[model samples]
Target chain A: MNRVFITGMGVISAIGNSVAENQLGLLHGTCGITKGTRLSTRYSGLLPFGEIAANDEALKEILSVTDPGVTRTTLLALHACKEAIADAGLTGAQLLSPDTAFIGATTVGGMCLMDELYNDANNPANNSAFAPFYDCASVNMYLQKYYRLSGIVNTINTACSSSANAIMYGARLLRNGLANRVIVGGVDSLSRFTINGFNALHILSDEHCAPFDKDRKGLNLGEGAAFLVLEKEADTNGKKVYAALSGYCNSNDAYHPSSLSENGDGPFLAMNGALKMAGLGSTEIDFINAHGTGTENNDEVESRAMIRLFEEPPAFASTKSNTGHTLGASGAIEAVYSVLNLVNQEVYPALHFKEPILATRLTPVQVHTKKQVRHVMSNSFGFGGNCSSLIFSKAG
Target chain B: MFFIHQTSCISPQETFSNVKMDLLHVSVHNKLLAIEPAYTGVAVGVLRRMGKASRIGMGTAMRLIQEGAAPDGLIIGTANGGMEESIRFLKQIIEYHEDMLAPGSFVQSTANAIATQLSMLTKNKGYNITHVHKGLAFENAVIDTAMLLMENPGNTYLLGGVDEIASYNYIIEHTAGWYKKEYTSNQDLYKRNSAGTIAGEGAAMFLVNNKKEQAIAELTALTTLHSTDKELISGQLKAFLKKNVPSGESINLFLTGENGDARDADLVASCESAFGNETTVARFKHMCGEYPTASAFALWLACYLPIDQPLPEHMLKKQGTTNKNRTVLIYNYHKNVQHSFMLVTKFK
Candidate 1:
């Protein structure tokens, strides 16, 4: 089988603008959660979220977006894609190659634009300006158009596991000899829709989310975009290697629409499948990025799954405590954080970890610690019992 | 080579059980809507949180997996994943402008929610993927499943195609004038010379595996055509057939997509002329309202057509004298934009 390698990565989160900045934030244990400045929400004062400081116009300016009617989601995606392509050392001249493809994952594509259009439809004057963003057929179409790449372009929207799935699919396509180099990641912008959606489920935390803590409330809604340029291990450029995505598995809970199984069966199967694919055992894993959404059901269920899988669980923490849950972009953003952990040789603390859950007896690493981490397993489970786990190993 | 072991569809026509031509008996005046089974029986939480789209997706998914054990992979396709909830959430945004928007609807608005909900409902812990490619939404999903099977043999995968049309809002803007202005019945769909057909929604699921079975359809070959040129389409079909089928044997049945659109109808006519009298012809769009993965419903029809004794009158374009049902061809072209073709042969 062919080996897939991470050649380059680009991330735009609340923590920092570039991969280096994000790494610094992770190292210093700086939390990105803050009061909303861009999104005017009813819970702005009550809730802390991992929202990007820049507005849509600034993001468009950063990407040099000529089209005025581009969706905020698309702008964020293009901004990250531009950085990723450049970080991979494959820019304007290099992207002309036909062997490259772009695979993106987004939960809602151009939805913010749609919301604006719908709002403007009542007034005929604003309708003309919002017409360009009305095409919501496929989110990948916009990315393909912007990148001007003639290769196969696709998007996967499997909820929170979306970006992880995109990365997994990119690796598979490369292994299957479909493309030589591929850009894979996810992007989502904070919308009233998602903020209120998590709120409706009563899973949105008004205060700073406490993952794996006894007094945990719920998740904080965040939004951003992240991408990784994946290439064959043998064809790596001169850039510093972060980590290689070794194994990935996606599964459905089939238990309920909104809740996971009590035994964490879905997550267990996904983690086991990923481990088996990577040819690693429970003892081989050094660190785990748990999908601790700070929700009562998710933390407990994930802890139970961990206990059932390993005799001595690996050092693990839910970065959601620091970055908040970015929904569709959570998987890719967390994967980037996992790669940073492996590259930096450190385990970032799971913010606000208190006593272990009474039922599972699992406690996450609460403080930042330097360690000889080799392999890191990241988990992203979303609504609809869609559980996905990706195992990333340091490139030796 | 993932063989479609079992397939089931709950559409407007009587397509769930033994397939025959009972679709013509469906009143043309009355819009042919799916005779939905009780959602509470299939979905555990249908009583509390069942939305229109989730209910349809979960219902069809459960029916597809009912006969066998849970699949190792689950993939779903939907153009608008949860537009019903999305529109609802959008309405909340409009009503409240920006304050106190309902989060439940917002979360469900993501296109991948259907797959997520299905996974949660089924507790399936395998490869879960969802694709939305306009008209080729389901076909892309089928292609993905095939690719996965090629890589991992002996693995079972559940592939489902589902979409729902909310009463107003998003559909009006997204689809525009795709549905008839006046409520035209399903029976009149073929007779009425309209630019678009009546808008409808449904969900269909198929359990496919690499293992051969007595009652199965070997999905031998699948291809897609981006262009609408009839000559190019014919050439692609001939090349695909030559690669998959025996040299001299002709396709037993050629199922063509015959939506009410004139251009699509012409394309189907060209296909019928290409096959001539050597193959039987059938059409399915009139039965199931036009949607992206309506081809999935057609594939379901092809799976049961051979086993069922009598053919339904509504589906028959040209009745064949021969009774041999060995191979079936499915060709679907959506709005002269996206074209997909599949070959399914009865397993010995």
Candidate 2:
């Protein structure tokens, strides 16, 4: 059996721009959710969000991206992917090899330029350059082209759980002997299309989101990207191994399009399936990065699912409480965070939680604590009942 | 090995449960729209809210259900997923200034909406994923289905690829020089010798598992190339064939996804020439037109085409009369960029 290990990780979220910065913020218990100052949405000032500090122009300039009509989604993805590739010390030859694969996930592909798409669609002379970048796979396609990657390139869009599935799929590619290395992650930018869409769903919080709280209102929409370089253990002879991607599973709730079942069947099945794949017992999982979208339904249902799984549910926290819900990027972002927990043998606390949901009455880790973290689980459930769980273990 | 137990397609032709021939030579006016089924099994209220892709996808699912199949998982592929609803929602956001917007179009506009709808309708709580790559979308879904079924040998997965053409999407692609300048009948798609191809839309689904019993066909080999260099692709295809097909064994039928675009002729020719002249070659894009997942229609055709009968005159692109088509190879590429190959053989 092939053992998959995470060789490198890169992340840019509302809390920070790099893995080190995010770790610092997590240590200091900094909350990134605030009234948006960079995004151009009408609700930017009217509602709080986990908006990245940099604007699209600043990001493009920082990344030296001169491509015309490239969306912020692609820019963010390129930013993190570049970091992950560099951190892994992958050479141009290695990246260009047919043995390397790139799997990306994004919900807001080019819709980040929602106004532009509308204008071009309505204009009689629709010679829009952004038209090519409008599809969900355009972000990955751009990455593959920019990096000159020649391996199996594909995109998965299962809403919020998109990137987790990407990670799992990348691992499968290695285990199936189809690829030697894979760059897996996801990205999503703040777009009026998604903001208004999520707003219409009435799940946007006016204030900072409070995950697993009795008074939790809704989730704060966020924008970010994350990528991780994964390689088989046999190939990581002298490479810096961040963690081992031990197990992963994707399961559907099949109850609703935008909500989970009351029993949290999707969440349970995903977590349990992953554990079974890892050949680990429930008690072996030291900490969990809960999905905890701060939504009324999600928080409670996730709590019930956790209680049902673990006799004494492991120490868990919702990083979304800090970065807000990053949508498509949350799964990968949190996976990186979970790897951080295993690497540093510490756990970060969920922010803005005063009381647990009355029904399940579960409390997340409320303070940053150093612990003997070995195995960590991260959960991400998307609007389409697409739920996925990934478990990362400490590597020697 | 992955076995296709049952297959269903909602193509421009009458290719659903009844694979009737539409040999009228009727011309498609720049676009080939799928001839949708009645969908009488679904409720009127529910059907009213479903998008065109969802309707075709669910209609196929219903057909599979009638055939007594309850798949445990679903994996779907689409290039332009629910674009009709996405464009509508985007237009409304711009028109109404994002006020009083309903979530119906927004929910259905996602790339994974068709798969989500299928999962919700069938109450399938198993593995579900959606691939959105341009030309290799369905091919990637097929790969995922094979991987999943390989991991869980007994589990049956509903694998599908669906793409629909909308006015906004078509106009954008047309403006980008993806469609021919003059409106040509689909029947004359190959004869036009034009630089661009006709746009098309449809849905194709298959119940796939590891079991060979009662299977329609077995997917033996699959490979995708992401290069424009013909020599590189040729070398890779030779290696793939050498590994999958027996030594000195020739492929009986070669299905090519040539949609009458002159720019793609070189690559198409390169692909077909890989097989010898003794092999019978066929094309299906004229019937289904050209979309990202149009290769799926070709795949569906590969499963249903009669084994012993002579080739349909309209489907034959080149080569001799159809012999025993026990072994088939489906070769397709989109705009000379994403190339794919799939080898299908009889279950026996």
Candidate 3:
């Protein structure tokens, strides 16, 4: 089998602007979670979020987007894609080749724009003005138009697992000789729709989210985009390989729509499948980026899955406490962090943990520390019981 | 080659359980509406969380891969996924934009919820994919699955397609001339004198494998075209059949994308004329709603036809001798935007 390597990565998260900024934040244990600024809500003062410290106009200028009414989601995605393209040192001409493809995953493609447009009584425009932001075609069409990428461009919206699936597809494309290089990632912006949706479920935390805490409440919402340029190991020209995407799996719980199954069966199966693909065992995983949403249900179920899989649970943390739940972008953002961990040989602590949960007698790593980390696992779970786990290892 | 081991579809037509050639009946009009059963019995917890589309998708997917062990991969296709829920949320946003909106509806609005729900229900976590490319959505997913299976021959994959038009949104969109203004009844679907077909909803699934079996259909070759010309479509089909099938072996069944619109029906007619009366022709869009992955339901219909040999009245366009079902061709389009052709033969 051909080995898939991450040659370049780009990220725009609460931690910092670029990949290096995010890495620095992780190293210093700087939490990006703060009161919401971009999104207006009564919950703003109560609930903390991993919000990018830029308004829509400023973000547009940063991304150099000319369109006036582009969705915040697209703005975030273009920002990350630009950094990724530049980091890979690929020009628009290079990306236009038939051998190059774009696979993007997102839970909401341009719903943010639709939300704003739907309320626009002043614009009173027809479908032509809003046509570019209402459908799935616009998402890829705009990206391809901007980048001039003519090859296969597709979108995956598998909820929170969207980006992980995108990465999995990108790797498979390279491995199967379908494409030589691909850019895969996910993006999502906080919207009134998502905030209220979580509020209706009563899962939004009023205080800072505390994953795996004894008295954990719920998750804080976030928004960001992250992208990775994937290529065959032989195709890369010694661009410092942060990590190898060794193992990945997506699974259906078939248990419930909104809730995970008891005993963490879906996550266990996913982890087992990914490990099997990587030709490794539980012991090989050095650190884990838990999908600890601080929700009573998620942390409990995921912790049980972790304990059942490993003889000794790997030093793990739920970065969601620091970054907030970025929804669809969480998987890709956490994946970037996982690669950084593998490259930097350090593990960030699971902040705000006081005691272990009763159901699963597991305690997450409580403080940031340096370690001889070789392999890292990242987990992203979403509504409709979708669960995905990706394992990345230091490139040999 | 990644072969289709088994397939199943739960649509408006009587093509779900039976596959007898005679049981497959042709519709009298161009658009056929699905007769939905009570889904309360099929899905339990997932049903509560899903809208009409995801429930049908999950039900059909479970039926297709039930006989085999859990699949190592899952790929789903939908043109406008979770739009029913999204529309509902949109309405709420307009009604109560200042209030806290329900996150459940918001989360379910994303198209990927179908795959995610499938994963949570099945606990089969290998590789999950969801594609949304309008008319070519299902074909893109199928191609991806084929590529994945070709790379790793030992693994099994679940490929599924689903699309739904809920009543309120259906009526609202129909007012915009999305569906035929005249064809209101399901019984009058296949009549040739309609501008648009009635909207419908259904789901189909197939368990594709590299290992051959008795009930398998060898998916020999598949191609997609992005053109509207009848001549080009016919040429592509002819070339594909010529390259994939053995010499002198005529296509036994030609599954067409006859959606009752004058322009699209003419395209199907031109292709039928290219093949002549030698092959038995079939059309499924009348039974299933016109959506991106409507061809997915047609493909599932073709896979099951050779097994049970159903002669349902809704499936037949031109009757032929009910000899053992052989090569079946699925040619479908998404409103002239995307064209897909797939050839599948019953494995001896």
- Tell me, by DockQ, which candidate is best: 2
lDDT of 1 by residue, A349-371 (tens): 87777787787778888778998
lDDT score at residue B89, model 1, on the 0-100 scale:
78
* DockQ of each model vs. true complex: 0.38, 0.75, 0.37
Report lDDT (CA) for all predictions.
Answer: 0.75, 0.87, 0.76
lDDT of 3 by residue, B1-348 (tens): 468877767777765665333433333332444445455335566478788788778777777556677888788888677887887776676678647666667777778777766766666556676798667778779878988788678888889888886444354345445578663554455765767666666788888888776546878777766566779788878887788888867888888877777657668877887675567887876567676688888787777664336446776789755444578888988656568888878763
Q: How far is B31's C-alpha from truth in model 3 (Å)? A: 7.2
Error of 2 at B288 (Å): 0.9
Going through the candidates in order, the fraction of native interface contacts each one reproduces equals 0.57, 0.73, 0.59
List the candidate numbers ranked by TM-score, top first: 2, 1, 3
TM-scores for candidates 1 onward, in order: 0.86, 0.97, 0.84
Interface RMS for model 2: 1.2
Per-model C-alpha RMSD: 4.1, 1.6, 4.7
lDDT of 2 by residue, A170-204 (tens): 99989988899999999998888888998989998
Candidate 1 residues B1-348, lDDT tens each?
A: 468877777777665554445535353432345656665445364434656666777777777677687887887777766777777777777677656554666666667777766665655567778877666778768877877987888788889888775544333433444556566776667777766666566778899988786547888877765565778677777777778888778787888777776546666666677675757787887777777778888787787775435456666778665545568889987657567888888763
Deviating ranges (above 4 Å) for candidate 2: A124-126, B22-27
Give chain B TM-scores in order: 0.90, 0.96, 0.88
